[model samples]
Target: MTLELTPILTRLQNMLQGFLTAIPNILIGLIVFLLFVFISNLVRNAVHAIAERAGQPRGIALVFGRIASWAVLTLGLLVSLTIIIPTLTAASLFGALGVSGVAIGFAFKDIFQNLLAGLLILITRPFRIGDQIVSGNHEGTVEDIQVRATMLRTYDNRLVVIPNSELYTNRVVVNTALDKRRLSVNIGIGYGDDIAHAKEVILRELAQIDTVLKDPAPQVLVKELGDFSVNLDVRFWIDPPIRREANEAQDRVLETLKKALPAEGIDLPFPTQQVLFHDQTEETDGHRTRQREGWPSRGIERDPRPLREIRPNSEEVDNRS
Candidate 1:
């Protein structure tokens, strides 16, 4: 029993002495790491200020600062680890990490993809904060763009978080990409209304609106002839192409046109259909030239009587024959 206990006591004594001997190194490493953390924060602030001064966007500046801070922190961590273990060099540490990084990358593939996509988006400047965009089923003002997701504030005041990967891969429409955007409205007038007069009236009314742009000039084109009326497309340009401004401009244009067109004797006609009834016994039956409703007159003319009047006359003619 004494012999067996002796080895256990000896191993415990060795461990204690080793721990005491390494205490100073441990303290030194801790102090160095803490100092490096403080220095990294200072570096982050300096980089942020410099980027902003260089005219970078706020998000781009922030990301650059964060990258610098992380690099500093990573270097400090390696130095601290080397201090704690004299045998561990930065090269050896990196070599070990290289093997593990593949597993980590697979484990967090989506996270890293979003991070890469976000970085590209910031660099490309496809859309900026406060810009209105439509992506998939989500459309709103971009409030903030983060490494993993983009924050959107919908027109109805709802918040939506979309993954950056999705935004980068899918098609996104930036409504405010240009300084001015064109808006079109279709208005139909009766066939009898003068096309030239209607176009003049629409263009004149559009010119009066303040939101509409004057340089490109407004246009009213005859689109197509419909069953009841002719469709005229009214197209104009507006500045500061935002949703609210566009809607307001459209509302004003519609109101002005609705009132101005009818007041000027231009008729806004609804769908009208003339239905005809025919009797097989009538003399005009199967005669394309004589039919008043189906076909146009081709030098042959006939008075169209009521179905009751034509039916009895046709039957009497048939009896006589």
Candidate 2:
């Protein structure tokens, strides 16, 4: 029995020897991986430097550089893996991954969409860092754009991170894109007041303000004739740098108008209803009496009696003729 076990041990030793001969392949795979990592790092640094020199924001540059570097490193890793294990060639790996890839993609669909949208935003550049923008219900200054989301600093100094997908699909209004913006305000005055004088006063107030542009000129139009007051639309052009000053300018303008109007004897009217009463007994024969003196009465009277009566037919004498 001892002699028979020796042959089986010899065969096991032969198999082990053959497997040990492939150890060099493992070392080569590790060397290739390290080389790829080094190359990827070098490329990433170079790209980051170029982007920085181009004046791109640090966050945006890092986003682009990291993405590019990782993409290259992933390809290198695949190659190394295939070399180590001959069964994992590109075609075979892709074919197998194709089935499971759909599942993984479905799980992270939103993330992928946001990533793509962010990339589109970086490329197209509809707005940039420090731009005041309003999208969906969010209004703020853009602080940075990442691979999956955009960061905004609100007026109240709160940080809001919004998904890039939503930002791309909705309407985006860039307030700072134009060199100038229009400021409009609706003001009301008493109906009987002089509109020309009111407009002149408004124009004068607007002219005194330093933020208001004089080239385009300020506009004053009578927008509507209200029941008790006249609506005046005041529109003025403002430079981009003066956006922060617009609110202050508006407040000052209103305050000035409020104080100036009364000095000029102009009245800012409020809503009011007037009612008139009449006495029916004071009416003459067929004429209705006026409700109030100098009220300028008009229209038909509300009388209930008939003006004349109709007579019955009497043709009996005509029938005999």
Candidate 3:
């Protein structure tokens, strides 16, 4: 029995010795991987800084940095793997990846789609970080563009994460795409006021606004003769055309127009409705129709009180009847 146990013990000792022999190599590989991680991080930050200084968009810089970092880290991981397992070569690793890529792609189809879209966005430059945009139901400033999603900071201060695939495939409205934006305000004046004078006052008031663009020249045209007033559309252009600025310009214009129009004897009209009594229900017995004012003559009584104070004479009532 002792002799039989000696062979089994020898096999166990051999396996333990092999594991101990690989321990140092495994430790060295882990150290090398840690060094690669540190280097990759440094390179990522450096690339980001360089790209930003070069006047590229933040999203573009981020993409460049992330790609660089991931590439370096991937290389390091492969090298570490080779060190840990001497028999596994880089070619074999990549070959195995190629073989399994189809299954991995299927499992992460949406992720790949967004990654591709993110790359396209960084290249095409539709809208940049900090630009206000509207896509589908989302309207907000672009916070950041990521590997698989785009982040938005809404006006109400909520963060939204949207898949890049949607943004690339759908329409996006960039409000700040142009240096100047056109704005229009409708003003209604009483029909009795002078149309020409009202227009002149509006244009002159618009000229006083500092934010308004003068090159295009503000216009005040009669949109229509409304029910209670003459509707005039006061269209103008504003510079540095952000939503906030445009809104401020509009407020100033409205306040000035209101005061200016009134001072010029142009009354801002209120909604008014006119009623006509046609007297369609009139008593006509093959003769002239009843007149409204004299339907009951002035001599007739319109008293509606109950007669309880005086008793009428029976004979007088009989004679009048």
Scanning candidate 1 in windows of ten residues, the lowest lDDT window is 280-289
lDDT of 3 by residue, 1-321 (tens): 345788899999999998899998899999999999999999999999999899988889999999999999999999999999989998999999999999999999999999999999988989888888888888888899998989998878999998999999999999988877899999999989999988888888788888888988888888998999999999999887777887898999888988888898999988988663323212221123333432434565644542322213334334444
Query: What total of clashing residue pairs does each candidate reach?
Result: 0, 0, 0
Cα lDDT listed for each candidate:
0.88, 0.79, 0.84
Error of 3 at 220 (Å): 1.2
lDDT of candidate 2 over 1-321, digit per residue (tens) = 355888889999988885686577677888898898999998888888989999986766778888878987997888788878866779998888898999999999999999999988887788888888988777888898888999988888899999999889888998888788888888899988999999999899889888788979999999999989999999988887334766776777788778888888889987999764333321222222323442334665545543222111223223333
**Each model's TM-score?**
0.78, 0.68, 0.76
Worst lDDT run of 10 residues, candidate 2, spans: 308-317
Higher-scoring candidate on lDDT, 1 or 3: 1
User: How far is 197's C-alpha from truth in model 3 (Å)?
Assistant: 1.2
Global Cα RMSD, each model: 4.9, 10.0, 8.3
Residue 170, candidate 2: alpha-carbon lDDT: 84
Number of the candidate with higher TM-score, 1 or 3: 1
Clashing pairs in model 1, backbone N/Cα/C closer than 3 A: none
